[model samples]
Target: MVEVRHHYATVRGHRVFYREAGAREAPTLVLLHGYPSSSRMFRHLIPALADRFHVIAPDHLGFGNSDVPSVDAFPYTFDSLTDITEALLAQLDVTRYAVYVQDYGAPIGWRLALRTPDAITAVITQNGNAYEDGFVPEFWKPVWAYCENPGPQTEPAVRAALSLDAIRWQYLHGVDRPELVDPDTWAADHHEVSRPGNDLVQLALFRDYASNPPLYPQVHAYFRERQVPLLAVWGAGDEIFGPDGARAFARDLPDAEIHLVPGGGHFLLESHLDTVAGYVRGFLTAAASPA
Candidate 1:
């Protein structure tokens, strides 16, 4: 079994925790997780890919094992989160690496790609969105409303949406085999969100997500210009992102690979670990090869 080591790096005065595995000489693969979850989400995937690639999975500030600064102390915007992640990578001497992104990770990964297009070797997205076409109106309605008018009236709804029940729903909603998904996933997430003042941090991020849509055109333009090797493996049944998000990549990067797992939910790794791993191993092997 491949061993995964946990470590923390001081980035911008915050302790950013991350999981690392595989040999240092191996090509790097950075894994960025989604909302209410941390590097913990990659526990299985890290080991699976560690044999072929050096894996780095980090917990963004305000989530996972990272320092949970009070909402007032940190901006909690995607841009700030990306800054911390980028700094952490620089500190680790990671100059070039492929990125695996999901949910909130999408925005952060895209920002990194935009900032340093030359640093990105390839892109892998699982339920990570870039285009407006990816948004499921019903799933994003309340979030869109709150982003537009973030006031006392809209705050309550957004807060409620972050509740433990909602977190659980995100895990089991579209999975064909809910029992296969570990309950500990959402339980750990709930524990983090339940921390004092963390709720406000999450709420702030939900509002700041509005900042991402405006950057979609830029992301699309980057895709067209760079023509980066992209593999979009998504959960077809994902209520939040849906299959269209995966297919959308093909529009920009014509050669991009798109696969939608049947009945795989938002957290596709939970239910389809081996399948995703297989695809990733094959894609990265070819993408990382010398031209």
Candidate 2:
């Protein structure tokens, strides 16, 4: 069994927490987490992939075990989050690597790839949006509304989206075996989101999420321009970013591989770790070969 190591790095004066495993000389895979969750989301997948690749998963400034600076102190926009995440990779001397992006991780991964195009070896996206078609109007209605008007009066309606019940719903709603879903996932996510003043942090990011769709053209440009190796593993039943999001990649990069896990939901990792890890490992290996 591969052992996962925990460490901290001081990036831009903030202590960044990350989980590392596998040999340093191995090909690297950086895992960027989703909202209301952190590197902890990759706990199982990290070890699963560590034998063949070095895996690094970090918690953004305000999430997980990392520093949770108030909005007053640090801006919570996607740009700021990506900046800190990129800084963390630089601090660790990780110049070239494949990144696994999910949800919030997609924006961060795309920005990192664009900023340092040569450094990104490949990309693995799981339920991370890169196209307008990925956004399900029904699920994103309340979220977009909050993004349009963010304030004290409007906060609660959007904030309800992050409530404990909602967090649990994200895990089990579309899953086949609700029993297979770990109770700990929502527990940890809820704990982090429930932290003092963390609601403001979430609200800030939700508002910033509006800034993402406009950049879809640029993200698509990267795929067309660089033709970066992409492996998309998606939960087919995800009500938020449905299977359409997975299929949308083919329009840009016809060669990109797409795998849909049946009976999976938004947090597919929780229920489909072994399948994802297998797909990721195989894709990376195939991508490394001569065409």
Candidate 3:
């Protein structure tokens, strides 16, 4: 049986929670989660890949079991989050690894890739977008408005999006088999967001999201220059980030492996664990093989 262990590390004066699995000598695979979720999201996936990989899934500072410092205490930008993640990896003595990114994790992963391009072996993106084409304008309209101008008028919509009801909708809306999705996912997320100051933290991140799109060109340039292996297994039905985002990877890395799972929504792993695990196992194996 694969053993998955949970632990915490104090990086840069904040408690960071992470889940670890697999043999220490094995290839490392870092799993980065999306918004309103934490390392808890990958509970099942760690064991599935642990036999062949040394898996590490971290809950970003404010999201999971990690320390939720006040917005004034922490910048709450993707750069700050990446800085903490990088420091955590350094403290853990992890040097090289593949990254599995989704949603919010995408920007963090990209920043890591840009910082140390040589250390990244491969990238597996599940609805983690970095292209303009990836934006679903209808779903992002309010977010864009808020990003452009943060005030009472736009803040209300953004705040509502963080509500438990909105969070629940995100999990079930495009999912074909909502019955299969575990209720605990959103419930736990709501509990975290319900924290006294967590809402402001989320809103800060939402406003900071405006900083990501402008870096897409640089990300694409990195892709073309490095030719790093990439696999994009996206939930085609994702309302927030459509399949086009998955397809956009091909434009830069022509050799990228792209798969759009029909009927899969934003949180694909909740309903299609087996399929994603299989893809990850096969791709990471081939990616680590001698060329």
- The whole-model lDDT of each prediction reads 0.94, 0.90, 0.94
Query: Taking the tens digit of each residue's C-alpha lDDT, what string does model 3 give over 1-291?
Result: 888899999999999999999998999999999998998889889999999999999999899899999999999999999999999999999999999999999999999999989889999999999899999999999999999999999999989988889999888878888999999999999999989999999999999999999989999999999999999998888999999999999999999999999879999999899999999999999998899
Span of ten consecutive residues with least summed lDDT in model 2? 149-158
Question: If scored against the real structure, what TM-score would every candidate get?
Answer: 0.99, 0.98, 0.99
Error of 1 at 112 (Å): 0.1
lDDT of 1 by residue, 1-291 (tens): 999999999999999999999998999999999988998989999999999899999999999999999887888899999999999999999999999999999999999999999999999999999988889999899899999999988788779867889999999988999999999999999999999999889988999999999999999999999999999999989999988888989999999999999979999999999999999999999997887
Give the runs in model 2 whose Cα sits over 4 Å from its true position: none
CA shift at 189, candidate 1, in angstroms?
A: 0.4
lDDT of 2: 0.90
Model 3, position 277, has a per-residue lDDT of 96
Q: For candidate 2, lDDT tens digit of each residue in 1-291? A: 899999998888888999999999999999999987899989999999999999999998889999999999999988998999889888889999999999999999988987899999889999998988888888898888778887777678788977999888888877888898889989989998998999889888999999998888988998998898999999988988988999999989989999999988888988888999899999999887888
Residue 63 error, candidate 3, Å: 0.9
Q: Which residue pairs in candidate 3 collide? A: none
Clashes counted in candidate 3 amount to 0
How does model 1 score by TM-score? 0.99
lDDT of 2 at 129: 88
